[model samples]
Structures are given as C-alpha cells and as structure tokens.
Target: MEEDTDFRIRFSSLCFVTDHVGFCGTIKSSPSDFVVIEIDEQGQLVNTAPSKLISKILPEPNNFAKKTKLDLQNLSFEEGSNQEVSIFAGCSGADQYHQSGSEREDTISDGTSKGEEQTVDDLGTLLDEKTNELLNHFACDIKEKWNSKTELIGSSPEFSLGRILDKNQRAILHSAIRQKFPFLITVGKNSEIVVKPNLEYKELCHLVSEEEAFEFFKYLDAKKENSKFTFKPDTNKDHRKAVHHFVNKKFGNLVETKSFPELNYSAGNPNVAITVRFREKTHKHRKRSLFEYQDRKVIYTDDSLRLGQLKGNHFDIVIRNLKNQINDSANLKDRILEAIENVKNKGFVNYYGPQRFGMGRKVHTDQIGLALLKSEMVEAVKLFLTPEDLDDPVNRAKKYFLQTEDAKGTLSLMPEFKVRERALLESLHRFGMTEEGCIQAWFSFPHSMRIFYVHAYSSKIWNEAVSYRLGTYGSRVVEGDLVCLGEDVDDEHFPNNKVHLVTEEEESANTYAIHQVVLPVLGYNIQYPKNKVGQWYQEILSRDGLQTCRFKVPTLKLNVPGCYRQILKCPHNVSYQLKEEHDTDVKMEGSHIDEATLSLLISFDLDASCYATVCLREIMKHDF
Candidate 1:
C-alpha cells in the first residue's frame, strides 16, 4: 500500500485535508472485504430486492402491473362537463416518486381484486368484459399478451402500473415490455406517450381542497398528454384513508398531489370535496425515461458516476481487513482511530477516483479520452485494446486481432464475459478495421461507455482544477470562487446550472463556504471560475492543444455538455469497529512491546460521486 505519487503529481490530487500522520493498509483483499450499497435520490437504500420479486421475472400483465402505478389519479373533468377526462395530481411525490420499488396498497381498479396472476377471468374483470374476447393466453399465436391488454384496457392501462418518478424503475419496466413485446415502442403526441381514446376511471376517494381541485382541473387543461393519467372517483373514507399507505409508500410526497384527502381536508371551511376526479400527467418523467434518455439529454444511462446525477443519492460503504501499520507508537490503534476521526470531521478532497481513470489497466481511459478529443481514433482504439492486469487472457486475443486485423478469429479465443472487448470486435468484424470503422466500433458501445472516455478526460481536467484550488487557495472559499444559488442544484429533471462567483463583499460576509463552492469538470457548456483557478482552467485546455474543449464530436455523434462538482466532500455517520481477525497474522517486526494483530471495520455514508476509496485514502494515507 504505497502512495501513487506519480498519479498525484499528474492528476493534481496530491494534498490531504489534515496535517496528521497517516498509516497504510490493503483494501479489497477479498470481494466481501469491500461492500458498497447505493442510496438513491429518495434516500431509500437500493438493492437487488426488486428484481427478486416474482412480478419482475417476466413481462406478463403482472409484470406491467407491478410497475404501472395503480395511480388512476390523473383524470379530472370540466367542472360542468361530465366524462371529459382531465388529469390531476395526488398529494404525493409525483415529481420525486416514480416506480422506485414502491408497492401501492390499493388493489386493481373496478375494486374486485384478484391476485397478480393475469387469468382470463381476471382480465375480463379488469377490462370490463372486453378482455375475455381480447385476451387469449393459450392460443397458438399467443406470443405477446401485454398487447391485448393495451387494446382492451385502452386509456386506463395504468392499472397495470404503480409507477412513480424514478426513471431507472421506468427503464426496468420498459425493458421488460421491449423484451416480451417489441411493439410497446412509440412516443405519444407532445412527444411523450400516446393514450387511447377510451379513458378508464377508478375512484377511491381520499380528500382534496376545493381550490386545489379547481387548480387541478386547470393544470390538466394546460398539460394533458398521454402516459400521464389517473382516473379515481371517491369510493369511501376507509379506502381514501388507505390512500395514505399508497401515497406514503409510492410517492413519499416527491410530486405534490392535491387530490390526497389528508393534505387539505379543511381548506377554507371545515371540509373539502370527498368525491372527485383526480388527474395527474404521470407520463411526464416516465415517457421521458423511455424516449428522452435515448439521447441522454439530462440523465446518464448507467448509475451516476457524476455528482448528484441521482440527486441526493449517496453510498453506504464498509471497509474491512485493515492491516495494522508497523510503528514505534505504543498506541497504534489510537493513531488509526485518530486518523479515521480526522477523515470523518475534516473531509477529503473530492477528486475523481482512479476507477474513473481505469486504474488497473496499463493505459488510463483519460489518455484514450484525450486521444478521442484530438480526433486520433487509431490511437484511441489502440489504447482501448491495450492489455493490463499482468497476463489477462484478452491480451493474447487483442494481440492476435491487432496484428492480423481478424476480429472474428480473436473472438473464439476471447472470454465471453469480456463484453466491451467482444462488442468492439464484433463492430470491427462488421465495419472493417478502417479509421472510420474504429470510430464506429467505439460508437457501438452504449452511450454511457462512449461518453465515459470524454467524461474521464474532462474529469482529469476537473481533478487538475481541484488540485489547483486546494493547492493554491487551500480549500477555502475565496473571492471569485463559484457558488450555486443555494447548495448543489444538480437535479436532472430540473437542473440549475446557474452559478455566480463569490465577491469580496460576500466573502467578507461569509455568505458562501467552501462546501458551497464548485469547480467545473471542463467542457464547452460550463463556465470557468473567475480567479486564478479559472486562468489555470484556460491554461490547462490550451496546454491540452485546444483554446477551448470541443463538447461535440460529430464523427462519433457524441455531445457532452459539462457539469460541476463540489471541491470537498465529508462522509456522514462515520463509525468504526477495531477488532483482530480470527486467524490474522500477528506482526512483531524488530521492536514491539505490546502490539497485537489489528483490523478495522470502517463504515461511512458518502454522497453521490464522492469516492469512498478517496475517503479511505485519507485515513490510510496511501494513494493506492
């Protein structure tokens, strides 16, 4: 566990937050030794539990129903006009809550409940008598069943879904649809999702204010579109009260739904309307997830590596198997504990971690990214094909492919699980290994992977800026440092890219702190800082062979708008358990009075894009 001084020197992540002496230990000695759990935007712990549910296993009616919100709440009417369906919101997290592993309490609409099993009888009940004629499960041409449900159910297909605002969950549901029934594709009018003419209504009354109800109709009048719907009528108080469970569980109030009974029971008077039409254009984010993200306009395809991509998202991490450093101090454990406390309190530099740079590989992705930026496709492809990890089997395959230009021949020797390599090879096999072919081969990757190299190169520039900030200004809020309107306003749905520099007056007033300060990741879209750091940013780009970085690569059809990240990161709820392992080796190198075997179980919660390894680096004082 030695410090990678070379990387630190090059990337500019060379400084520590604390002045305390540091110790060293090995990390990820085993797979279980290091564990990471993602905390999504809702602050709920994300796991594979949702996939384990029987409903998610296949694309059946239950599969669609599983994610499709029981939220038939969007439908309202012109106060005087009956059966004129308008959409309204429920008093819940319509903005924040999408199909985020939430299970709604209310059963199927039309109120007679069968289980998740999509039987003929259940279909008949759900579709109001048309489904029996429409749904044919056992028929010879029974390839796609969900299609029949769409036709029979018409505009009220949301009964099959208990969706929220989580785009990832929507993607998961849509993926199932695409897998089973490839024909569920198509954006509706308004470029969202199309709705059927027949609207299905299910009214389980809770309560909403008279004014909220009126405003609800107004919102629907202006913003009515397909995929955003709910049709619920006031059934009873208990069912409405049960709406509490549905609201709390599914939306958690991310999207404000005025239709919920409890929100404003006594709006102006002592009461409000119990029976009502509630419509909310639910397809806003859901369809955006389906279609908008294909261009990756706002959100990344993968779990976000960038800061606050999943707004408020964080990580719950555990680091174990900590080897005690050999030292003269009588209290080595105390020293280690003190270091951990410093990291907990003082925080660490929010540098992009080595994983972003492709640490284990012989060549880093940032190098490849820079190559791409320079339009050196051959160099970039060669860098990508380079081998690492001290005798990986792919080395032989890569060697044969590069030497012979035989992508298909190399595949037989290549490992099946090496999907990126396989994909590159397949593209090359089809497109031939010309310069254009090489660029296209890179394009064959998912948008995220294709964009990642550029992101990494930008990350290197960001890291350099961070290093300059810490090293020159010393991690303090200074005059001309960039600060957001408030805190980090990186919500993808509604981003606030606006930033202002701290003035001398503001700095004197202590208006903006270091935590509030930000550094650009460097791109065509982002504005640089106003001070010397900004000058460094410009100089860095010019040094990289461009006066300004190109955000678009027309050759690759890639567009990378820039982003910002915090300069410093502090972990939350930090705690540690120091214990000796069961069969740990006790070291007694030269001089030891009373030192026994030692290990640490260090745990912390870090916000999205803050590296846990960087936190551990601060504690361990080893850059590796």
Candidate 2:
C-alpha cells in the first residue's frame, strides 16, 4: 500500500476528505468515527456512508493540482487491491482513465476518446470541484447538527471541542467553524452561544465574525435604562403617606399623585404604586432630583405617568348560590339574607388574616420579631437575612454565604438590584462581625421590614387571643366585654378612647347587636380587660416569655404602645340575587329539576381590616 506522506490529520486540523465519498468538504472536529461527504449530480454536497470507500486512502498532495487530479481518477477502483487504479468514467467535464502502472484509456465509456488528454486547466477544474464539494458538504452537516441539537436541548448547544482551547479561543474557533460551515451559532460578548437560524450560508459566511457575534450577544443581554422613579415607604408610614412624603422631599412641591389604598404596614406584600410629574421637562430636573437612598429602589423621570387606582376600603362581592337547589325556590333570597343576618348577629371572629404572617403555611417574620423583642441580636440578624425555604437561587446563595460567615464575600454574591439586602450587608461589613454589628445591620434594614417583625409578633398574639376568645365565649358580648365605640378608630393607642366596657344593661338590651368587642394587643400602655378573653391574652404573652414592656426597645424605637382590635366583624350592605344555574353548579342526585334552576348572587361590603373570605365562611359554614 502507498503512503500519503505529505498530509496528516491532527487535533484542530481541518480535514477535507472522509471515508464515504472523495469530494466531501472540510470538517473541523476531533477524529472520531469515519464520516464522509460527497458531491451529488446537482453540484450540492450530500452526506453518505458508502461501505466500499471506508478503507480507501488518498495519496498525499505534494502539489494541490496534481494530487486532486490523481485522486479523481482513482475514484472508481475495485476493493482490496494493493495498487488499484480507476478511471473517471461518465464524470461530468472529465474524460480519462488511468490504471496502476498503465497508460490512460483512449476510448471512454461514452464512446468518445476526444479530449482525453490531461491538461493543467482540467487539474485546476477538478481542484475547484473538490473544494466546492467539500465546502457545501461541510455546510449541510453543520445545519443538520445545529437543528437537531437545538431541538433536543430546547436551546443552543454550547460547543466544547477539547481542553486545548480556552474560553475565548473556543469562542473564536466556534465562530470560524460556523462561518465556514454556515451553522447558526452566535457568539455572545461573554462567550455565550446563542443560535439564530435560517440565514443563507453565503450571506452569513460573509457577514459574521467573532467580534461581531460577541457584540451582537452583548446587545441581546443589554438591559434597558428605566426612566421612572420608585419609592418604598418607611415601616411606620402607610404607602399613601410614604409616596406623598417622597414626592414632597424630591420635587420640593407636590405633583399630581394617584395611588391605591394601602394595606397595613405588615411583613407581606409591601409594594405600593404611585405616579408623579415635574413642572419642567428637563433631564437636569429629573437627574438632579435623583438621590442615593439605601433600602429603597427609587426612579425619577420626566415621562408622562398614567396609572389607575385599584384599591378601595369597601368591596362589593357577589356570591353565587346560597343553596345548591336547581328549582327557583321563592325563599332563596330570604335564605341568603337570613344567613347574612345570622353572621351579623352571631359575630365573625376577627383573627389576623394570613397576610400578617410571611408566605406559606409557616410564618418566618414572627421569628425575627421575637428575636428582636428578646434582644437576641445575632439570631435576629440570621433570621432576617436568611431566605425562606421557598426562596429562589439568588436568595439561597445570599443565605448560604451569610450562614458560612463570609459576610464580606456575600456583598459581591448578593444581587446589586436588591437594594434592601445590599444595605444590610453593607452595614454588616462596615460594623464588623459582632453581636452589636449584627443588631446594627438588622436595624439598617428598611424600617418597614424592621416594623414588620414587631407587627408579625403582635399579629401572632392577636390571632391566638381571637381563637381563645371565640372558643370560650362563643361570640356573645358579656358584662366585662370591651366593645369598640365606632368603626373608624386606630388600634395603636394607649387608653384607647374608642373602646368602652359593655355594661350589664347594654349587653342585655342588644344581645344580638354586640358585633364589635375589643381585645388587647399587648404593649407597654395596654390595659388588659378584666374579662376571660383578656386572661387568654395574658396567658399567651406569658407562654411566649414576653411582657408588655418587652415591646419598648428604646434603642430601636420600635415601642408597640399597645392598642385594641375588635374581636368580631360583620358584613354590611347585604343583598342577594337569584339567577338561572349554569353547567358549573354541581347537581344533587335523586333531584328532578329542569335546566332553568336558580342560583344565588349575594353582595356585601366589610371594613378594610376584615377579610371577605372570613365573612363568606360565616355564611357558608365551611373551611375556605
């Protein structure tokens, strides 16, 4: 067997020949299995695995023209011969035959020996044919692989050829390979690969470069600059008040402000929306107004702001169907009305809703609040900084780093966009890793967050007190019951003027009308009722190893000057409507009712502090 001495396949080398057909274009891959590309009759590259040519070897090229001409003539040789030679018979633009150690055949298979003589131009023509065939074959293979891999992964595949290439080098090589092969690989600025498809091979090969791909990817990953302002309120301020204060502080004058009704300043759902405008339409006014505020993400802008308010203290809820009866019962409205009246008379439990606690079944904010109340600074810091079980990857990383005592390291790992967390970590780094430092860091968090901890603890106590009061007294106002005077009273005041003890005469006069009884939210100035419900509140406070004075943290100024909350709530403006039943209503068995059955729609409103779901529970008498 003759050896091809001049050419050798090596790692990262471009190979133009394969085992299948002789005319396949270059492939840039590590040597693996024997794959080949061939030129079809239409001058397009085709991938094939012809068994006969698997063992065939091409002679090395001392000269490009001579070597290609010789290889083309040897394309039809019989298998397993030590020195087999073949003719380029019936091949387009070629008419000759060369046998090993023999002269060229004069009469071709087409019965024409004319122009059978070898020429330099013919060699060059063959070389171009081989080059074009190989290039086209390479492009087809790339397209096929790119499409299949992208489909399989549901994204672009990251190409890693070998360990020899560094990240940037690999990206450059990938760009070059994609250009020659006409694949859809896009090299990002950070060397990330993105796949863009259906580009014409010729056009793509000409237009794309490694630098261009890098820039294109960078552009893809670029973040849009926001021209709006954002402001979060202090823990003590309601969202409405916070926005008002923020606008006044920045603009020096109040702008047209529109905001939704604010919820209680609790630990959960603390976001508020508001829009403001400036008198002048200058970028300087917008930019100069911007200030560096920690524990808040603020945006200032000159864009026209349009927002609709979505919150109201009163809600008109429509409940469909009091009873699942299909027939139009004449007393259906009366039944629903009676249910609403029963709820009002019996009184609904005013336990703190799920929003008071942090998300999920387990409440985390209460733990942080308790730690702060007990002056356990280290525990408070840990509880506040660490993420909940359901937190995402970024939060988990921050938690892990903080737990591992890498406080300084956590600053870098923490997201720059999380202003609150960044402020906490920056405080920790500044104060040094001590208990006092931790407390200071905890304090440095958004005032709203700090207040949330205290509020959550108070809510926990309130919830327990309400549960105990309901279980014992069963919603009846007794002699010692503290009834709130009116609905529009704040809960955070000592010697609350809104609450008055229920006298024996008043309790007896309107036994059913006692819908509002006040309970103590334990704090320094709270006067617990001498009644049984107040005893439950004292028991809960004692069980948690807390006293009213414990809430007065002078350093933190988070003193909860105890307040009163109504023990019971009732819905008002009650009304009901009956309509024909739809397919959604589940029918009871053994009931013969036509399709024109009636359904109920009950509408009512409740106080802002009360949950409509709780009111519904009273009417439905089922767990919601």
Candidate 3:
C-alpha cells in the first residue's frame, strides 16, 4: 500500500506497476498522491499496442518494468498459487519505515482528502504509519505463540525473528506458511510472524529443505533415550571387603607369635635372679653369680649360661649341678629342664647376661652361635619337641635369613638385617661414651645378643669394600669402595707405602682366573724389471725401410707458436740441410748392404729422458 518516487515510474501516460501484482495503468500525477491504475482482466499492466508504420516496435513500453510485472503476474491464479509476493515503497524513499502511534493517529485526521488525488509521496507516508502499527501488534502476538513451551524472552519484533534473516529461518518460514498455515500473517517492517504453532511435534525430516532432509532424519535417530537411573560399582568397596576377609581368616583379633607360647607357661611365677656362696678346696669362701657350685668349682652360673658361655657341652651336668643346691622342697633339675624346652620351642630360654668380649661384644656372638649349637644342652631341649613344633624358634629364624627353603612363596619373613644394624648404631649412640667400653657393660644381655647378631652380620656384608689403587695424592682406587687414605713421600723415593690391606677377615673374596690369546704382524716386498728398455718395442724400431712410427703427441702445447711452426721451421734450418748432406756418404756406404739387412743396423737407443728434455725445452718451454 506504500509507494516511492521510483516505485511507480512515470513515463507520459503509463504508471509502472509497484504493487505485489505489477498492474500498470494510465494514472498520471495531478500534483496529488493517489495512484489510479488501469488493470486488465488477468491483472497485468495494459501496454499500448503498436501502429503499423512503427512495426519494429517502441521498446514495448518499459521492458524492465514488464519483466518484473510478469514475475508477479502468476500470483493472481485460481488456486491462488499459494505463493506470497512482497514489494517495497518508501515514506521518505525507503521501501519500509516506522512511525510512532501518536504520529499515525494524527495522519488519520485527513479524512476529507481520502478520495482526492494525493501525490505518490503522500500515500507512501500513510502506508508506512499503518505498517508500523501492525508490526508492533505482530511482535506481541509472536511472543504469545511461543510462550507456553519455548520460554520466550520478549514481545519486541527484534525477538520474534533474529535481526538478520538467515537461509534456514527464511526457508522454514516459507515452508511453514505454505504447508501448515496459509492464513499465517507477518506485518512487521521485516515481515516476521508474531504468533505461530510450535511445529517441533512434526518429524524434522518433513520440514527441512530437500538438501538437509536426510541429515535431519539421521540426527533424530542418533539422539539416544536416557536411562531411568544407573549406579557404577565402587572398587574401593571391594578392596575393603577383601581386607575384611583377610583379617578374619589370618590375623584374628590380635597378633600372636606363631613360635612362642603364652606367657604363663613358666614356673607358676616368673623366675628372678639369685646369688649364691661357694667354698674352695683350700677353705676360701666367695660370693658368685653362679646359682649352684661344688667346692668353689662353680658348676652352674646364671650369668654365664644365659650368655651362652657355660663350659661343658652336657645339658645334664648343668642340670645336676642346679639340683644339688636347690631350696629345701623344690626339684630344680626338672625346673631347669622345663626352662630349656620352653626356650627351644619359644625363642628366648636364657637372656644374654651382663658381660662383654671381642672387638664388639660376645653377647652378639652368642646369639648367632647358640642357635646352631646342637650340644647335649640343646639335645635335651630337642627331645621335648613335637613334630608340630618343627617350625619352632630355631627353624623360623633360619628360614627368615633364607637359610632354609621354607620361606618361599610367602610374605617376606626374615627381617632385613641392615635395618637392625641401624637400630643398633642408634642404641650405641645413646650410651654417651666414645671409648666403646661402656657399650660392653650393657651389651651382654641375651636380648642384646639376639639383636646384635643380626646387626653385625649386616654390617659385615653390606659395608663398602675398602681397596686402594695407585698414584693418587690420597688413596687411589681403580674401582672399589674405599676411603681416600692421605699420603706422605718416603726419603728413599721408592713409593713404598702403597700397600693395601683388608681391614677385616670378612672383607676377603674367593679367587678365580681368566686367560686370553694374542697375535702379531711382519714386513713388505716390491717387484721391478732389471732395465727400463722394452725388447719387442726395440725389435720393431730396428726394422726400418721408409718406416713410419706413430707417436702420441700431447695436445696441451699445440696452441703455442712454436709447436706447429717448429715442423715448418725444421726443414728451413741450415743445420738440418748440412746434416742431410753429411749423412749421404754414410748412407751410400750402408746401401751396399741389403736394404732389409741394413735396416736392422739402423737402430737407436730411443732414450726416454732425451726425448723428454727436447720436448720440454723446445715445445713446452714458453707459458703462452
């Protein structure tokens, strides 16, 4: 309903089509704005027919306008074509423009001039106002259309359709209007719908453009349905369950030693240390740590036996001596026997008593030595062992050190002795004396003996090897663990103090030998002919009768002035002519002999040095 200056172009009598249907007319401008078009029966512009004299035809009255008109002409058909058409007009000149509601109301006041011929510009202004009002209403309606399900954000036209129309929006709108809702209206400046049904309920494949239809179907098929609920198993829960099973089956409620008995198996009470007196054969009396003695012979002593220093290898001797001095009603021999069996099955029978020996202490030695001591004392203890006690203290300790094969296929049972060595070092550090004597006093306990044996052996095996090499200012090691021993030079200049000695017997290694093989090389030989002369070459040279010889001439000096000129100048020389005349006499004399026979006597030495000298001096002498 709007128009622009160029919307309906005027050319004398005809008004070009400007509406969606390009119906032309004989409408002329009367200085007013209304268009009076003359549309034909089919709604096409009526072009003026041509006269006979001008048969070639006047460009057919606005051919450009006619083509555009033809495009819109199909819209007015019986089935209505179901196609929408759009055209543009301007208020100032644009095809579309907005107007305030107040401005639109003021324009409506000119009712009296409605039927009058308004200029094209005046009609365009009115149309723009009406369209703006429709657009506002359309935007509000579009929001209501999507509100229930789509969570619409605004009633503004800007929200109804995006600011710029993309291909998909245009295609969807075009298809939706044509197929689903023919009455659907869009009235905004951009012509976007205000309200429409949600069409997602329909299959996506039905609505997309032909090129995208297959992809849309695949998209729908790929969107999987969600599960109602799910739960992933927790692996931590299983580990805890496994730990629970192990605790129930293996460790029970408390950790008890497999090789030791319950604490109450001794004399109904724990044994405490006792001191005794002894008489010598010379009638001397003395107090001793021995529990039983005869005539000061000290047959049995608590400290010595406990520390594994008891003299005899017989268990009965010690047991009988203990019995001879028992308190009135007790059977001491039986008690001693019971204690022996107790230690044999359990770990500790006698505690390492107060005493010291060797570079370190003998208590440590006793712990290691006593376990392997199968004397009568231990034999007495062994007599009481049941087959079920096969894995008793002695056996278990041996297995821990990997001395016995029983430790295979189980958690590591033997304590790593190095760990014990560090612990002993720490214990020794707390004694506060550097002289090492104080350590000996407290080190003799049976318990210390056990701990020390493990620690000492660890120190011996794991400590660095201390071997020395040569020539270094301090100790030189080719490759071995050793402390750098500082140096001093001897007066004799003999480098004599380089001897390396093993600090401990434990440091020695077993010996073995390896052997190898070697090879040598000798001198060189050369071969040469006795002479430089070639015999077959000389024989050929000697036979001559107007003989020709082919010489290999070098090409390098040929460009020099003398080379080609020398051949010409040779005959021109007087020396060459005289030589020829003098040779005539000799030539005549030699001719008396047969020419073939004389040819053999005409030999020349053909010296290589003489030829080389002549070629060098005459032909190749000049640089140019």
Candidate 4:
C-alpha cells in the first residue's frame, strides 16, 4: 500500500479540510512534510497542517480562466531576475505532480514542456503574484459593500486583507480614486471617510444674503458698466462686504471679470480694507487710482500700499541699544539674557503701553473714552477736535476757529479730509447747543473711533487690575488663586483662557504653573474673579462712576463681551547680537560721545494682542 501524505500548494490559495475548516495561505516544504502558512480570518499569518487540504477556486463570469492565467504570467517574474520559468498547478488540465524538496526527479505536467525543471525562485514569484491578486479582489469587494451600505468599512474583513498587503499604498489608491471619480468623498482628521461634499462648499453657495443679492443685481442692471464704489473712510464697515463683493463679481455681475478687497491706506492701525469689484475695461484705471490714492499715506516712510495687501494683527519688532555702556561690575549681555529668562519664567504684570494713549503730553486718549462712556458728549467732542499749540499750524488754526467761532462758520475752516469732524460740527449747528444736541453731534463721528475710546478705557482697567494682582499676590499662585489651563483658544473645556480656582488640595499638589494667572478685560458679560482681584475691579469702576451694564450701549448698538488674557507673555525665538557703531558724532543716551560704541540688537516674535514694548520694558527695567 502507498503511504498517504499532504499535497503542496501555491501562495494565497483558499483551502478546505474534510471537516470544513477553511484558510488562505502560501505552502512551504519542511524537512519532513509540507506546511501551509495560513492567513486567518483576522488577517494574521500562521502555520497550519496541509494534510487533507483541497484548493477552492472561485470562477469569474467572463473570460475568468484566461484573465487569471494572464495575471499569473504578468506577476510571476521576480524583480531583477533574468531566468524564465513557468508555473504548473495540479488541476483539471494537469497530468503529474511534483513535490517540493522530494528526492525523486521532476516529472512534467501534461500542459507544460517535458523535462523542464522549476526553480525555488519561480515558486516564490508565483506565490507573491497570487497573494497580491487575492488582496486586490478582496479590497474591491469591501469598497462595493461600503458604497452599498453607505458606512465605514475600516473594520471589514476584506479591508483587513488589503491593509495587510500594503497600508500607505491603499490610502494613496483611495485618494486618487476619490479625485478622479464623479462621486464626492471627505476624509476627516481621524481617518473617518464620509461620502459627502465638504461643509465649505455648501457655505460658498449661500454666502450672499437675499437682500445683498437683490441690491447688487439691481445696481448691475442700472449701471450696465462696472461701477466703482468706495466705502466711507473711518466708518466701521461690515466684514460681509467682502463676501458679497466676491459673489457679485463671480456670478451676479455681467461685466466684472475679477474682484478683490481694496486696501485702505488712510485707516490707522487695525485698518479696515474695502472690497472692490471691477471689469476688464476699468481694471487699468482702478490700478492707477490705487497707486495715486495710497502713495505716501502710511506713517512709516518705507511702507507702501497696493490693492490686496492687508495688515496682520500680529507683529515682530527689533530693538537695539544705540550705545553699549560696558562696566567691570556688570556684563550687559548676561544681564539682558537673564532679564529675558526671568520674565519668561516668573511673568511680568500686564499694562497698557504708551501707544494706547495719544502721543502728545497734554492729551490722554483714554479720557476721551471715559467721557463717551459717561455720556459727556461736549467733553468727548472737545477732546477729539482741539489741537494744542504744539500741533501743526494748519491744525492749530482750524482748532482755534472751531473753539472761538460758531459751528456753521467753523465748518468752512476745517479741511476737506476732516469729513467726520465737519459732520459733527454740522450736527451741532443744526440741533442747537444743548446737551442732547451735543450728544447727537458726537454720534456723527465714525463708529470705529467711538469704539476705540471704549477699548482704550477697557485697556486702562486691565492695566490697573494687573498692577493690583502683582502687588498683592506677587508672582506665585497661592490658595484660592485662579489659574488658566493652557494657551489654546479652541479647547472645548477651557476656551478663551478659562480659569479654575485653586483649592487647598491643588495647592498642596503644586502641579499648576505660577505664570498661568490671567487678568480680565472688564465688560458687561464678564464675571469678575472672586477675592481681592474682584474687589479691585469693582473699586476701579466705582471710582470712575461707571457700572458694568453701561458697556451695553443701546444707542450705539455696541455690546462688548469681555474676555480673559494672560497677565504675562514670553518672547519666542529670542536672539541677540552686538555690532560696533561706526559713527562718532551721534549722541549716546543724551550724552555727547566722540568714541564709537557697541550696540545690542535684539529680535523676537510676540503673540497677537500682546505688545512688544511690554517685553522690552521687562528686559530694560525702565519706562520708554
């Protein structure tokens, strides 16, 4: 009787036992017997017995056999191998079987050439090709199911097979398919795939309001040619103007080919840029007008304005010491670095820098804000228009006329560019000189300037609060101290510098950083911190004879919801260098010097809403 043994198999061939246990794997020959490296249901590879195993082949409906044979031939060759070989399987067309590592000589299968021998390299290639074909078929089946069910197929068995084959390769293939096909697919940050267009697409379609669309279309019909519209300077313009302008130029207007935001060169810091749309016919003229309008308008001589250039809220500044005064007792470089590090680690009390107020010694802009808050319109108007003797002759003459002459007569003396000021004077002239008339006249000023005053007052309140907090608590957090979690604005748990009061347990834990304390920007909607800090906020407002509810100005439609901000800021990417000054005639620190001196140059970036001068004050330990 002949001895019974298991049969040899190709890679990725599905096999079944008499007991109906099924597996897919490549076959390898051990010294004594044949073993199948099986891929389990979980897509993990494992060794199993090949005894009583039978191959299960699934046939395709059209040209299945021919395509399979072609695929096998195409994929069988190993990379960089020169040898030519053929694969023969034991099936309906085969006549002989060759066992791997058997001592007996190879016998030809009926379909292959007689006396041809197979190499180990040929067998490995055959296995690899079949394995890849199985994986591709598996991936396609999973994709079809995913499309039908309209659900994620990440946990599907077929997807697991494809993942086992190649992880990054499958991702690239899916991305390409999504881009090429008509169907839309969205992949989220967590790799969750959804068959839907992005939310931004829907938002783009509905960006223009019905009222805006009607007005824009009405103007387009009347004009026929593209119209040049300029927004009122110094006014608080709506941000939606940009969106409306974009939609009108892209789809509504018949003549316009492009649209862009118009750069406002005259608006001071935190300037608002207007949106402009134009046709090909007006493009050249509009371009020329922009150059003429903004030329020499910026405060800095080196700055120039173009149509689309917008200002960023954040800025980086470099400050250098004009003269490096060296002393044996102290090293300037070491002192500067130590000062910066100390501020970074220990934190400095926050204050509204000099720029928040007007530049002149006689006027404080915060006072104007306070007068507006108190509804003292006459004071607000006087502060806005009155020019000191130090001001330019043109401005001084205009101020003198406004103070001494009647409102109607003073209008003629005001400059043409003083549109807001002239409007206020005209209102005062028409409404009479009562308190109500003065209030109405103040209302004629630009809404932005009115809001600026309110902001300046808020800054002053915050500066005082910071000073009080530091004076009482010093730099470290004590029991009942309020500490901010982190610096992320989008964190759901701690949005906008949310703080938690330190309990006795937390104080003992000592995990919270001392520099995490934040101060409040006083407004109607803000809840004041509990303790001395809260008392300080109340005292400041009480001293000014103002209430938090006063921030809700119904007449102006301005409601400020307050927010918390860090009491200290650290400079990032800080660096310093020393260079010798070549000029001898220049004065150093108000002293006449004939010798060349070394200058300390420092550079760093600061977060938005924080002043660079604040950091410099900490480093210099002196007022500017």
- Estimate every model's Cα lDDT from 0 to 1: 0.51, 0.44, 0.21, 0.43
Residue-wise C-alpha lDDT for candidate 2, range 580-604, written one tens digit per residue? 6553322223233355444444444
**Sort order, lDDT high to low:** 1, 2, 4, 3
Please tell me which model should have the higher TM-score, number 3 or number 4: 4
lDDT of 3 by residue, 185-270 (tens): 22222322222222221222223232342332222212222211111122243433443332222212111111111233344422
Q: What is the lDDT of candidate 2?
A: 0.44
> Top TM-score: which candidate number?
1
Instruction: Evaluate model 1: give its TM-score.
Output: 0.55
Which stretches of candidate 2 lie above 4 Å from their native place?
A: 1-312, 316-347, 361-363, 486-498, 502-513, 548-550, 575-603, 620-624
Ranking by TM-score: 1, 4, 2, 3
Candidate 3 — worst ten consecutive residues by lDDT sum?
514-523
Clashes of each: 49, 7, 15, 0
Q: Give the distance in Å from residue 565's predicted Cα in candidate 3 to where it truly belongs.
A: 99
Model 4 TM-score (2 dp): 0.46
- The ten-residue window of minimal lDDT in model 4 covers 3-12
Per-prediction TM-score, please? 0.55, 0.44, 0.10, 0.46
- Candidate 2, pairs of clashing residues: 24-134, 25-134, 229-299, 229-300, 230-299, 235-448, 321-600
Q: Between 1 and 4, whose lDDT is larger? A: 1
State the lDDT at 241 in candidate 4.
54
